[model samples]
Target: MKAIITVLGRDKPGIIFHVSEILYKVNANIVDLDQTVLEDKFFSMILVADIDEINCDYNDLKDKMDQLGKKINLQIKVQQEDIFNAMYSV
Candidate 1:
């Protein structure tokens, strides 16, 4: 399965490293990523990952992402690709 992970918060140096680390631990392979700092202050990112080989279930990944976000002061969201697409489709 595929998933989309979105992150947003104040710009920081290790956001990508930290977020990717969590996914790595769960064996979620990053297929694509896009990030940018808005007005040189806020950080935003959208990452697409392949989760078919993840070591744990989706909830586990969400929990891990949530924990990391709390630790680093960011807003992180994880959604199955299908759900994400559905939510945005009109």
Candidate 2:
């Protein structure tokens, strides 16, 4: 399964490293990614990852990412690609 992951927070170091580390631990293959700092302070990132080979279910990964986000003071969201598209589509 492919999923979309988004992160938002104040600009700082190690955000990408930590986010990627979590995905790596779950064996998620990042297929596409884009990130930027807005106004030189707000950081935002969006990525698509393949999670079909992961051992754990989506909820487990979401919980882990949620914890990581809280720990790092960031807002993180994970959603299946189809659901994401449906929610955003006109």
Put down candidate 1 lDDT per residue, 1-90, tens digits, no spaces.
899999999998999999999989999999999999999999999999999999998999999999999999999999889986788897
- Provide the lDDT at 3 for model 1: 92
Query: lDDT per model, in order?
Result: 0.94, 0.93
Question: What TM-score against the true fold does each predicted structure earn?
Answer: 0.93, 0.92
Please write out the lDDT profile of model 2 over residues 1-90, one tens digit for every residue. 798999998988999999899899989999999999999999999999999998788999999999999999999999899986788898
Q: Cα lDDT of model 2 overall?
A: 0.93
lDDT of 1: 0.94
**Residue 32, model 1: Cα distance from true site in angstroms:** 0.7
